[model samples]
Target: MTKEEAKKKWDLTRKMLEITDDEYNGVTQEDANLRFVKMKLQIAVYYMQLLDEHDSEYQVPWNKEQFKWALRKPVGDKKKQQAKEWCHQCRLMRDKTCTNWNYEEVKTA
Candidate 1:
C-alpha cells in the first residue's frame, strides 16, 4: 500500500479503537507498527468470517497460526531503552536539573 493509504488505515483503526493521544504517545514506534498490523489482521479475520457466513463451505486460505502470532504484542529492547530514558528525564525534571526536557513525555504522563 502507498504511504497515504497506510496512514489513513492507521488513523481510522486508531479512532475505531479509541486510542487516546496519551496512550499512543507512551508506546514506541515498533509497538505502534505492531498494533497497525494486528488491526489489519483483525480486519482480515472479520472479512473472512463474513465470507464464511455467506457460504458455509468457504475456507480461509491463510494459516491461522501466523495470524495468531501476528496478533501478539512484541517485547523489545527499544521500548525498555525508551522507558529508561523517559524515567531519567522525569527524574531530571523533578530535580529541576533538566534544561531541555521532552515536553511530549510530560504531556502524556
Candidate 2:
C-alpha cells in the first residue's frame, strides 16, 4: 500500500479515538493495553517507507539496527505509567519509525 493509503487509514483510526482516555476506556475489556494498536500502526506505516536507512522512495532495509530499533521496545519507557503515553505519542510520530513495519510484514501475505 502507498503512504497516502496507510495514512488515510491511520487518520480514520485517530479520528475515531481523538483522545487517549477515550481510546483506552472506550474499548471494552481492553484495559488500556490494546489502546496503543492505533498509534503503533502509525509507526509501522511510517517505518515501511520513511526512514533514513532507506531512500525517500519505498525501500525496505533488512538490518540488525532496524530490527533492534523497531522491536526492542514496542512500549517505550515501560517503567513509568506515564511512559505508556510517551510510547504511544512517540510511535505515533514515528520517532524510531520501526514498530509497525515489522508486524505488518509478518501479518501480510
Most accurate candidate by TM-score: 1
Name the runs in model 2 displaced over 4 angstroms.
1-21, 24-31, 51-109
Put down candidate 1 lDDT per residue, 1-109, tens digits, no spaces: 3334444534643354354465467677666755455444445433333333223233334344643444345734443443334334334334352223366533432
Candidate 2: give its CA RMSD in angstroms: 12.1
* Model 2: per-residue Cα lDDT over 1-109, one tens digit each: 5545555644653463344666556755343434454455334444443432322233332233533343333433332233244345444444444454566543441
Candidate 1 positional error at 97, Å: 64
Displacement of the residue 8 alpha carbon in candidate 1, Å: 30
Give per-residue lDDT, candidate 2, residue 61: 27
Q: Candidate 2: which pairs clash?
A: 44-100, 44-101
lDDT of 2 at 20: 60
Error of 2 at 19 (Å): 6.0
In Å, residue 37's CA in model 2 sits off its true spot by: 1.7
